[model samples]
Every structure is written in structure tokens, then in C-alpha cells.
Target: MSAPSTVLVTGGAGFIGSHACAELLDHGYELIVVDDYSNSAPQVFARVQRVAGRFVGAVYELDIRDRQALSAVFDRHTVDAVVHFAGLKSVGASTRRPAEYYDTNVGGTTALLRTMHEHGVHQLVFSSSCSIYGEAGALPLDESVPARPTGPYASSTWTCEGILADVCRHRPEYTVVCLRCFNAVGAHPSGLLGENPRGTPDNLMPFLAQVAVGRRDRLQVFGDDYPTPDGTAVRDYIHVMDTVDAHRVALDHLADGPGMRVYNLGAGRGSSVFDVVRSFSRACGRPLPYEIAPRRPGDVATLVADASAVARDWGWRPSRGLDDMCEDAWRFQRLNPYGYEGSARRPGADRRSDGGPPIR
Candidate 1:
């Protein structure tokens, strides 16, 4: 039999990346994780090994924008495909720092693509977002809808999709699968890994988890006067594991043929902000404190996914429900109140001053 494919995972030390690494390793694929640790803690590599029961091939603390350093990683490993997940991903932050977002998200992607071309590593599963759909005219947004990104972060992803499309037009050998994911919440069920954003948490799940664990005083309900069932904005929150599984399936689909493909990865159901808070409160066994605030600028009323295309084409489906998402998220937060940084201080845990133990 042929050797297993070696996948290069950008931002592998982050929230979703760490789960992806665990999944990839469990499936017997080699991993070369590259991350700058700018938005993630490096301790995750160790947890990945523990979860997978094997060592990753390698881990490089390098930025994707650094062409030379990234090229060196390519030289050292026989990378077969790439799962690109290393980009600035905050919508609000993107609005404030559009130039920085463009430089990192678009510019970094440009550099990574160039280096991949130089090395002839063409297969890529890009981590795109549904925010690119902006305020869609219809509910249950599908891949066929015209992209109308509203903020810099979403625009950066939209720009990358266009670049990949153009690149594919010129390079038929390249296969790119853009997974326009909806909200990715929850941690791995093992409670070993979860979303651990640096500084204040931006996403609702993490913020809610923090509040439940007393890391934060209360939750901030952004809006409750929108035109929805509960007057709050609604979104499709997919468990992180489900999102990671979609990436794996995308890779397999790409291996079968070489062409550009896009899929919406979501649960195909909408849950309002109040819905999530109630779910999380049940998970934590108490009512979490919160206050309703005015709707933020550019906030969409509802953003659900059709997700029928992926089911039809790839036969992929999300098995986890909203309750599973809440329970797993709270478990991770309750266990690691301070995240991986706190993991080091646990009894018998090997603590490293420079971001956990070295890879493997």
C-alpha cells in the first residue's frame, strides 16, 4: 500500500487547528503544524499528541507570511496537501484593522500559495467562513448565493476565494476545497482541547464558557431586538468536531479528483443568541448573568446554512446537536479555567516556560 499522506496544517495550535491535528493523526496521516502562536498557545501540540496517542511529524513556530521560513518547512517535509487555517478571523477587529487583516489573511495566503506552487504541493482545504455571505437575501445560505461580504475579515476570505479561483483557472493540477463554515463552537468531547482565544474572547461560546467558569463577570448579549423568533440574531452553530470532520472529508474528496469545490459546513438549523445562552446555562447548572445591548453595526438578523450541497456531494453530516456543543464547551472551561496555560500547572503536568513541551 502507498504511504499515508502528510498534511501541512497552518495555525495547527489554535482552537480548530488542534482538533484537526488530533483527527488527522487519529486517521494515521502525518502532520506538519505551522503557527506563529500570535493568537494561540503553543501548549496545544502536546495535548494533540496526548489525544491522538502518537506524535505529530513536526511543529514549526513560524508565520505563514514568512516565505523563507515556510519554504524551509516545505523542504523538510514531503507535504502532500495543506489545510489552510491561519488567518486573522475576528469580524469586529477586522473592521478596526482592515489593512492588518488584508496583509495577514490575503497576503499570507498569497505567500503560502506561491510557496506551495514552488514545491508542487497543490491540494488544499481552505477554512473559509459564512460571514462572506453577509446579509443574504435568503435564509439557509447556500454555496450558489453571490458573496456579499460586509467586513474586512469576511472580505479577506472572499478575496482569497477569488484568488484561488483564478489560480485554478491557470493551474488545472491544483485542487482547492473551500469550506465556508458557519459558527464553529464547542470543544472536543474529551475536554482535552477547546477554543482558547488570547485576551478577551470574541465568539459567543468561549465568552459564555468563560462566564460560566467565572473568568468573566457576565455575558454581553449583542442584540435582542432583531426580527427573529426571540428578537435576537440567529446563527448555525456547528460543533468544532463536526467542522473538523468536514475538513477531512473535503481532503478525501479532493484526493478522488482535481478541481475547485466549495461547500457550506453547518448544522442546517438556526439558534438564536438567547437559545445558546439558555443551552449554556443548562450545561453550567445555573443562569448566567447577561444584559441586552443594542445591535452592533453590520450585524445580520439571521445567518443559517442550507448545507444540502455537502450532504449531497460528499455525504457528510453533522452528528452533534446544540446540547452536545454546550456540554463539551463547559467541560473544557471548567477543567481548564485558564486554558492551556493553566494546564501546565496541574499536578504532574510537564510545564514549559516557552509554551508547553516541544512538539513530540
Candidate 2:
């Protein structure tokens, strides 16, 4: 039999990336995980191995922007495809450091794509965000919706999409699927791996989980004066597992032919901030304390998904609900209050600080 297809997963030790690694392994794909652990803990790989019940083919603590290093990985391993998830993903942080966002998100993607072209590995599934669709012109934002990204993070993502589209236009051999994901919440059902943001959590679910577990004093509700019924922002919160599954399906689609496509991955539903708080309260067995604050800059009133395109094309649908998201996330938080650090024997240990030189 031919060898199992080896998929190189950038940021493989990260939140969604780790889950994707497990799912890929379960589906019988060989994995080469590359992570710098800049915003992730090293122990996540161990947890991922536990979940997958097997050893990953290789693990490189390298940044994707390191073209020489990334090329080395391509040379050493026969990477059939890449699930590109290596980039900074924080709206507030991106706003603070626009240059970093552009350099890492756009520049890193350029480096990876260049190396892929050199190695003749042409299939890619990119981790894009719904943030690319700024204030949507219509509800249930679909793939056709024009992207008017607001902040640096969204702009970088849009730029990366453009880069991929251009590559596909010229190189018909490159198969690229940009999965524009909605708010990715929840942990794996095993509770072994989950969202573990560094410093303070940026997203809703992790922040709420921290509040429920008393990591923070209380939750800070961003705003409560929007036009929605609850007057808070509304979002299509998709379970992280569902989001990872979309990657699998997209990779499968690539086998058919070389082309560039974009699909919104969401639950096709919206829930207000208050709804999430209420749901988490039920999950935590008590109401979580929060104080409303001024609206965050670049905040939108409502952002849901019209994921019919992905569903119709790939036969993918979100099976988990809001409650399922809350319960699993809470379980992860409760199990490890300090995220991976809480249980990690060597909390900050890394094999190498700099990614080192590319392997010969």
C-alpha cells in the first residue's frame, strides 16, 4: 500500500490546530506539526498525542515565515498538503500591532506558499476568519459577501485570501480552500484539549470560562447598546470541532482538482453576548458576574453565517449546539484552570527558543 498522506499542520499545537491534528490522525492521515509556541503551550502536543493515540510523524517548533526552515520541513517530509493555521489572531492585539499582523499573517503565508511551490505540494486549507466581513451588508454573511475588513487582523486575512486567489489564478495546479470561520468556541468532547489563549483571553468563550473558574475577577461585557434585542453584539458561535471538520472536508475537496474557493463555516445562527453569558451561567450552575463597558472599537452589532455553500458542497453541518459548546469549554477550564500550564510538568519548556536552522 502507498504511504499515508502526510499533512503539514502549521500552528499544530494551538487551539483549533490541535483539534485538527487529532481529527486528521483519526482519519488516518500522517501529521507533521509545526508550531513556534509563541501563543501556545508545548504540552498541547502531548495532549494531542493522547487524543490521537499515536505519535505524530514529526514536530517542529518553527515559524512558517521562516522560509528556509519551512522549506527544510518540506524537503525532509513528503507533505501532501498543508492546513495553514500559523498566524496571530487577535482583533485588539492586531489593532495595537498592525505591522506585526501584516508581516506575520501576509508575509508568513507568502513564505509558506513559496516553499510549497518549490516542493510541488499544491493543496492548502487556510484558517480564515469571519472578521474579514466587517459590518456585513446583509445578515447571515455568505461567501459572496464583499469583504470590507475593519481592523488589521481582518485585513491581513483578506490579504492572505487575495494572495491565495492570485496563486490559484496563475498556478492551476494549486488547490486552495479558504475556510472563513465564525467565532470558534468549545473544546474537544474528550476535554483533553481546548482553547488556551495566552495572557488574557481575547474571545468570548475562553474569557467566560476564565470568569466562571474565577481566573478573572468578573466578565467585562463590552457593550450593551447595540440595536439587537439584548443590545449587545451578536455572533455565530460555532463549536471548534465543527470548525475543524470543515478543514477535513475542504482537504478532501482538493483531491478532485486545483482551484481556489471560499466558504463560510458557521452554525447559521446568531446568539447575543447576553445569551452566551446566560448559557454559560446555566453550565456553571450560577450566573457569572459582569459589568457592561463602552463598546470596543471595530465591534459589529451582529455577525452570523449563511453556510449553505459549504453544506451543499461538502455535506458538512454543525452537530453541536450552544449548550454543548458551553459545557465542553467549561469542562476544559475547570480541568485546567491555568490552561496547559496548570498541568504541564514543564510549563514553559521548549525544545529550542529560535526554530534553529533548517534541517539538511
Candidate 3:
């Protein structure tokens, strides 16, 4: 790693991106953030500054798919590396709007790569998902397994990784780190920032948090007839803090003679829907209401991560457990019932110059 001092973070105001910006600032890297507030709010950067006690270099409200706008970002700053977290992340939504997913996820990645090349910037850390491994092989899947993405979202992620690999193969100067992540839950533990999904929350933990905070009457568990021990779908849930920390570690390793390196970032275990409900019940000091429903289309029964490779490579592992995820997530939900609804918008200077469509 060549000690990158500046980072351009796409989707910086979003859930994981915001946290990563704060983490990077703490590590003494200048930050230039880009997000259109599609799934996030602008006020997030203010809270991020408060947490880090450091001001970001700049923030731009623009869709990354706009090459002209993205190039403007690089033109303004000497971005040494980029941590990309921008995309439509919902699994079900991707299945429904497969075209949107492609136009944004795959298209945005290609645009970002082209811009990076033009500016002579090659190091990149991509926020990928374990969903790309969907329904393939057995439990505790590793990186060696062939990618057989089952859903549109997973396929988009797989496509992005392939694009990065192709770029590396052609341009060995490019350093790319792809983190194939499992379910990312929990908040910063500060209660200031967390997952604030618009309208209906898609992920399991955020939905459960909404129920705990009385935002919803009850959560609808998808299925309880899966072949798992608990007869419910299972997933590996890692705290959001741990997830962002992995990005930082990967960034630090980018200068270590890199072509392309992929690692699985996860807790190396599974948590069922019922198990999360019970955990959140204890965290919120009451049993949240829930009912079993038919399994949603493209939902995986069980997805666990064999993150031993990341541990061996980066010496990083998830220290937080499911209880911690529940506690922290509940804290954020309990503190903000509306989830950044009325929080002030404090995005730094550099508003979008060109009109662009927001991520939908």
C-alpha cells in the first residue's frame, strides 16, 4: 500500500458509505464524497463530521452513472483511491427493476472505472455482496466457489466484480479490492447514524428495528419452513462498524503489489429470522410482533460466509456478535423513530452542476 492520503467515496452519505467516510477521516485520509441522496440524506455528513471531529474535503450530490459529473469529482481533487458503495442494494427491488439495477450498478461501475483511468487513479475498493454466491454450493461458502448468482442484485454485484477483474487483467497498475459481504446490520453504536431506508425497509434487521420502534405494527417473517434447524431462512449478520473497518483494512493493503484480490467479509455464522426477533425483543425490552408469510421470490434459505481467507490475509475478523447488532440497531431506531426524517441537511459544498436522475 502506497499510503493513500485522499479517497473519493461514492454513496458517501448512505448507510455504509457514511460510516466509512468517518472511519477514513479518523485514519487521516482526506474525503471527497458523491451521492444524490437517493437512498440517503445530506445531513448524514454533518453527523459524520461530528463523530470524526474532522471536516470532509467536499461533498457532491450527483448520480455516479453520470460520467461527466463523476469526472468533475476527479477534476477537483487528487483522489488516490476510491471506495465505491453506491448502488441500488435491495434484492427484491433489483429483481423487479432489473434494468434499473443494471443501468445503475453495472453502468455506474464501468463509468467510475473509465473516469479513474482518465485521471490516472487505479486503486479501488468495491463494496460487493455475498448474495452473488446465491444458492450455490454448501454452507460457509468461500471465495473459490464459482459465482452462480441467483437474483438480479447478486448478478449485478457479480458483474461488477468481473468488470474489476477484467480491468486488472488488462491494466496491472490497477489495484482493486472486492469485499464479498454478507448481511450488514447494526449501527455505529453512537446512535447518531444508522440505516434509514425510505418507505418500506427491505433488509431484515432494519425492518425488525422499525417494528421495535413502533414505526410498524409488526414484521412479516418470509418463511419458517426452510430446511434449517429453526425452519427459518438464515443469514450471516455482521455489524455495520465491522463491515466498514474491513474497507479501511482493504484500502491499506491496496499498495501491496495488487492486481485484484477478493475476500469474504462476514461473521462466519448464520442467524435465522426468529433468532433475530428474539434478540431484538431482548434489546428493545419487549417482544416485537411478527407473522410468518410465504417466502418472497428469489429469497435464499440460508447464506453463511467462510471468512477465514480474510482473516488469514488481512488479520481482520468480526468481533461483534448478533446481540451487539440487535442492541446497536435498536438504539438507533429507539433514538430516531422517523430515521433522519427531520435531521438538518448539511452536505458540504459542491452541489451537482448537471441535472441527473437519482437512484430509484
Candidate 4:
């Protein structure tokens, strides 16, 4: 198999996509980014620009659903592979808007694959999720675990895996790698980019950041009565940089023609709500304010990764620790106080661009 000389990153302006774009750039891969700005900002392009050290890639404000637009970008760029990160990913939002979730996550992937086929682009690296293993009745989850997606968000990811499988089976020339990512926390070391959840964050790290930034009142410790060492739910919180590192390895797997593979990208460790809060406190040198509330509906007791597969297959491992995750998240939150609401910070506040607040 030949190396992927050029690449296309879908949803490249959003949180994960943006970081992946920077990683790809550092590796000297020619890049083309596609995003609709539905949940990000145009300023992200500038951020990626800084990460790249030059304006070498193109950014198209196009949605994946628009096949013509996607095809046009492919026609304009000589793309050798695709890293698909374009999809709706909120669990609660997915329940409220199931059809939209299916359309964007599942339908958009179908469209992207068709466009890739028409454009003669065969290699792909998909961003899957551990949510597919809804209630992992066990401690560590491996790639062979049965998927039981409890919500539309998880269902959508599983559906895409099935789509890729069918696409690969039908086209012998096509190659694909699906990465099942655990909870991705933390920010880039440069602090130039990070997880930018638009609305009130649903994840733990963002919520902690909000408390640290004084945007929210206090952290709500959900379900303190769970059957665990801490009596609260524990999760495998892998750093975003580590997740990006796995993407690098997955891309290499495809570039090196290792055939189709699925790997769980994680730290192989667990951090409870209290553990995260303590880490943040240590990182910022301030105790995070919090309250213990009933476990939110559908909360899992314990969910961590059996990261042995990826480590064995690609020789990859997470380098960042929990404290590192806290520090980076704090940096991003400290840099952007308002959480990209696009509202002015305050009377006579400084604004970066006339572009306005971030879109959710």
C-alpha cells in the first residue's frame, strides 16, 4: 500500500477536528478542512493556521450533507485519505432530536463515503465512540465487547461502523479504520485550542472548567451512592492530545496498509468525579466548589478502556496524565472566559474579531 500523501479532515474547525488538523499538519500531510460552523467558529481556522506555521490548507464552510459541495472540495484537492469527524455527538440532544442525529451522523457519513468513492479516495479513519458499549457490565471494555448503544448518539456511531463495514466488503480496494474513543478531556499544550462545547457542557471536564472560570455556580457531583471505591461513577478520561495521538497511529495503520482495524483509544485508567475535581484543584491551586446531587438519569457506574488492543496493534499509549488534562482545560477556559457565546465579554470588553460568538 502507498502512503497517504494528502488528506481531508471533515469537521476540522470543531474541537476534536481542529486538533487532528494540527496533528496532520505537523506530519506534513497536505490538508483540506470541511466544516459547516454549526457548532464552532471561523476563528478556529486562524488557530489551525498558527498550529500549521503557515496557511497551507484550505477551509470550506460546507456541511457533509451537501454532496455536491463535498465533491467539489474533493475535486479541488488531491485527497488520498479522509479522517471523518463530522457528526452530531450530544447524547441528551440526540434524544430530543433523533432524526437530526441519524441524518447528520449516519447520513452524512454515507454521503461522505459516496463522495470519496466518486473522487477515487479509498482510505478513511473514522471517529467512533465508547458509548456504543452503553452499560458495560464489566470494568474494562475491549474491542470485541458487544455494543449496546442506549441512546441515539451511540447508535449513530455504531451505524457508521456498520456502514464502513458494508462499504469495505463491497469495495475490495477500500480500506478503513474505526477508532472507539473513551471520554476525551484536556486541551492542547499550546492552549491555542481545546474542547469548545457551545451550550452548557454535559461532560465533566468542561463543567469543571466552567466552575474554575466562574461561569457556573458550582460543580454538581452526580450519583454519590454508586457502587464504587468513591461511591461516584468513574470514567476513563483520556486526554485530547492522547486521542489525537491515536488518530496519528490509525492514519499510519491505513497509510501502511494494515487492513481494517478497530482500537480503543484511552488512558486505561479511571477518574471519578471527585478525582477530577481534586485534580483540577491541584492544577489550579483552588478547591473547586461543588454539590452532591442524585445520579443523573442513565449514568453509568464505571466505564474504562481495555486499551491493550491499540497498544499491541499500533504500539500507541497515552502520554498525558490526569493533572495534565486539568491544567490544559484550565488554560483554555482562562483564555476564553465567555465560552464562545459570541456575546461581548462586558462593557468595553476586548473582542478578537467582528465574526462574533461561537455557533452551537
Candidate 5:
């Protein structure tokens, strides 16, 4: 039998990485998932496999910063391209630990690039963030807008973007596409794989899910006095399905072009915090317990996307609405009351977090 065509996915065990892995498998592309399991668990691979229903490729417990280790994987498999998703992403945490964020996010990306160059794998799809826009003066932020990342997390993303741009400029053979994604929320419809943050979550959706499942007390409505409609902050929340689909589109786009490019992936519509809370209440069959709180540092009033370039160039558009996001998230919360831990506790399954939820 012939070896399957493979693509390397760094951080494939993480939330967005796992979804991208499932999407790639559905399209018949074999995968090589590389993860450090620092913020994610090895058991996620089993859940992804169950959702995929077949083994696609290898899962290497490796970090991107370790060039020799990453090179070893490249030596073993024919990696056509890489969907780079490994990085430290918490904004608040990055504020407290900027040096670690720079070392991991920036240093790790440089290592990955060097290894890819050594292995002659040039094509790459980088996971950038819309926070690169900082506080956009315009309503809908476009690709042409200048990026001024206020925090270390966003700064690291911007730094990597510059590095990839320079690499692609010098190495004409390299093909790169940086996707600047906005809020990535919701869960897979199957409720088999979803966003499972370690410890307490800092993001809104994960925090909201905890509250819905009785893990947390209430949602914090940050700044109900902002000058937006309903006096709340507004943000572009893209569904995980749509976010993964954009990744596929970016991969395909790289195949057509052999140079560096960037596109914003988002719903192109901003929803207020109140809007999200109301939607969550409607989806979960109960009112969300929320209280108005002062806005946190570095938060902007409204940040939506202009998405025309991605749609025009890659023929991609976000299909799911706010309602779909809330519904899928509510479903996942209801089914997996204790997240993946709930599945692990069933008879015949190991309760340990390291092992796959023993195939119940």
C-alpha cells in the first residue's frame, strides 16, 4: 500500500487545532498532529479520532520550539504543508508574562520555520488574531488596516506575521497565508469535541459554558456603559466550524499562490455582550445570571471584520449565525456536563486525563 499524503498540524490537540484536524481528515488529507500538551491533553486525540472514525496519521507529543524534535517528525513523514496553531494565547496572562509569551510564540515560530526550511516544506497557514488591530478606529477592520497590537499576545502574533512575510519574501519558493481570526466560539454539532480549557477559562464563551453547566455562578457583563448599541462592548464571534472552513480555504489558496498573503476570517458582524448573554439564555432554556462590571484593561468598544478579501479571493464566508453558535455550545454543555471528564467516568473508561476516555 502507498503512504497517504500528509499535512503537519502544530498544536492539533488544542480547541481550534482539533477542529482543523477533523476538517482536514474529512477532506481525505492525512495528518501529523504535533502538540506539547501544555494547555491541552493527549486524550483529545482519541475524541478527534472518534469523531473522525479512522486513524489518519501520527500524533507527536512535541513542541515547535524544539527544532530537532520537529525535524525528526518531518524526516519520518512527507509533510506537504503546516497549519501552525501552537502558541501561548491568553492576553491577560501574556500581560503578566510577556517574556514567556515572546519566547514561546515568537521563538517557537522561528524554530518551526527553520525546521520546515530544512525539510523543504515551505507552504504554511499561520493562525493570526484580529486583536492585531488593537483598537481599530474604523468600524469594520480590513486587511489594509495597520495592525497595532496593544498586548503581548497580539504583539507576538504580529511579530510572527512579519517574520513569515520576510521569510516568504526571501525564499520565493515558500507559500504562506496568515489568517487573522476574530472570536472563535461554539462547539462541534456532535458535541464530541469542543473547547475544553484547562482550569478556569478566561474567554467569554468558555466562562459562559461553565456557568450554564453549574460550574460557575454568573457571567460578568463587562462595561454596560460603552457607546455601542445597548451600551455594551461589541465583537465579531465566528463559529468554530466557520473558522476551520477558513483554514481549509487558506490552505487551498496557498496552493494557488506561491507568496505571502493575509486575510481576515470573521463573521463581519459585531454582537454585543448583552446580545450574547440573551442568546445564551434563549439557547439553554434559562436566563443567564449576569451583572454589569467595569470593562477590563485593553478592551475596545467594537471590533468587527471586513471579510471581503477572504470572500472575494478564497470564496469563503461564515455560514453560521449567532444563534447557531449558542445552540451548538449549549448542546455541548448539556451533553458533556463535566466536559470530556464526564465521558472518562463511564464504566470501562479510565478516569485519568492522560488516557483516552476508555472507549465506553
Candidate 6:
């Protein structure tokens, strides 16, 4: 499999997925994207087109679990590979709605795998999470550590990876790369594309951005009495661009052989919640208001990545820092305070997509 030319990107309307769509298009890969817009918006492809200066091959608004719709996408497009990003990702929501998470994450993955098998597409890049690691272990977590998934979200990701591994084992032609991503933050840097999650955001940076834009009054710092220097839970926040780059690189690496591989995709550094708040404040040109609160249950002290393996193997490592991430995120928020629905409409696009070939 010499670098795949056509890729089907699930969840292409969401934050990281949308950025990845633009990146893949920039690299001259045709994309067939699908997203239900549950947590995302449809107007993102306009910004994606603005960024890439090229339209997507096709865009389908449907659930990945729909074998007919998924197969229809494969049937219509010459999909050489698949980039799986469609699923419920909120850790808190996953716990509250474990059944929904399993049904969407686990069930959707199975549906996707079966559809791919039907189409004879054996190369896949799965979007997994470092949350599956559960807690900090040996300072910076590595791939060698045994998975100890805690919540439903992490457990679902762990299960998906297991299923992918089984697929590779049973089917010799399968080549899969499961990227256990850390906190993926930042915007497109163009100020045109960024995260705009529906309802209240479940992630820290987006919530902080919302507050900075006056959509919310103040942020609630989870804890300020942790063992770390900042006395707050720490996480490895990798830029969305770097994370997308790793996906493209991983897709190329699959050309090496037919086997299942796992890599920790992160910045190999940790930043506390306070650190992000302070940096976000700098980006917004003001100190964002905040109040310390009790530590949320199941929160960890540190969740940095030992990303040396990916660096050594694919020559991939995050290039953007916290300041860069915050600056871009703030730019997107500042440009569109009310998110996608309320943001200024692009020149040739309204609330809907940018006129790609529809699924129907």
C-alpha cells in the first residue's frame, strides 16, 4: 500500500476531524467524510475549503453505525484507506451514558470495520485516547504500559483497539495504526476553522475559550491542591495540526506492512489546568476570571506522553506549544464567539455544507 490517495474520514465535521480533512485535502488526498453533527456543525466544511482551497470529494451526514450509508460512501468513492474519528468522546458524558458510548463508540467501530472489510479496505488509522491509560504511570506514559482504562470512554477506546488488533490478526492484509491521543487542542491557526461543540463543552480549553469570549462569566478550576507544582491536574495538550500530521504520517507508515501498531500521540509534555488558564489569558490579552474548586473524581495528577516511539518511527512529534495552541484557539473564539451557528457566514456558504456531493 503505497500512500493511500483516497481516504474516508469519519466524524469529519468535528474539531480534530475537520482539521484532518483540510490537512488531507492539502496533501492532495481525496476525502469522503461523514458526520451526524451531534456535537459538531455542518458549516465547518466552508472553513475547511477556505483553508485548503479545495473542495472535498463528498460529505455525508449520517451515523457510522449505518452500514448502508457507510457502504454507500465506500461504493461511491474509491476509498483506499479509512480514518476512523466518529464516536462520542466526552469522558464525563460517557460515564453518565455508558450504554450510548458503547453503542456509538464500540458499535460504530464494529460497523465501520465490517463495512471496510466488505469494501476490501484493510488500512485504517483509528483515533484512540490516552485516557485509556487511566492514571499516571512511570512519570510519562509509554506504549509498553498495560492498559487500565477507567471510565466508559477510555474502556470503549481500549476495546476498539483490541477489536482492530483482532482484525489484523485474523486478516493478514489488515494494517492498522491506533493512535492513543492526549488532549488535542488548538485551532487551524488561520482563525477560520476551530472547535465549536454544541451545548456546554466537555473539554477544558473550549470552556476556557467560551469564558474568554464572554459567553460564560468565569471558569471553574477543578482543583488547586494536587501534588504537582501548580496544584492542578495536568495533561498533555497536543496541537490539532500536529495530531493531524501524525495521522497522515501513520497512514503512510501502514505501507510498511500488514500488522496492527499502537503509538502514543502527544507532545511528550504536561501542563496543569492553571497553566492553560494563564496561557489562555495571555492569548486573550486579559486574565480570565477563575475560582478553585474540589478535584473532580477520577482526575489524575499528570498524563504526559512518552512520544519517543512515534518520533523514532514516523519522525513525528508535536510542533506547537501551549501559547500557540491558546492563541489559535482564542483567535477562533474571538472571530466567532457564538460558535458555528452564530458565527459570521462565509461568502458562499450558509448554515449547511459547502455543496459537496451529498450522501443521498
The C-alpha RMSD in Å for every predicted model, in order, reads: 4.0, 2.8, 3.2, 4.7, 4.8, 3.1
Winning model by TM-score: 3
Off by over 4 Å in 4: 256-259, 339-360
The residue-level lDDT of candidate 3 at 77 comes to 80
Clashing pairs in 4: 342-357
Cα lDDT for residue 207, model 5?
85
TM-scores for every predicted model: 0.94, 0.95, 0.95, 0.92, 0.92, 0.95
lDDT pick, better of 1 and 5? 1
Range of the 10 consecutive residues with the lowest summed lDDT in candidate 3: 351-360
**2 or 4: which has the higher lDDT?**
2
Give lDDT tens digits, candidate 4, residues 110-129: 99999999988899999998
Each candidate structure's count of clashing pairs: 0, 0, 2, 1, 0, 0
Clashing pairs in 2: none
> Each model's C-alpha lDDT?
0.88, 0.87, 0.89, 0.82, 0.84, 0.88
Model 3 spans with C-alpha error above 4 angstroms: 343-360
Our tally of clashes for model 5 stands at 0
Q: Evaluate model 2: give its lDDT.
A: 0.87
Choose the strongest candidate by lDDT: 3
Least accurate stretch of 10 residues (summed lDDT) in model 5?
343-352
lDDT pick, better of 1 and 3: 3
Estimate the lDDT of model 6. Answer: 0.88
lDDT of 6 by residue, 321-340 (tens): 99999999999999988887
Model 5 stretches with alpha carbons more than 4 Å out: 1-4, 342-360
Query: Which segments of model 2 are wrong by more than 4 Å?
Result: 1-4, 342-360
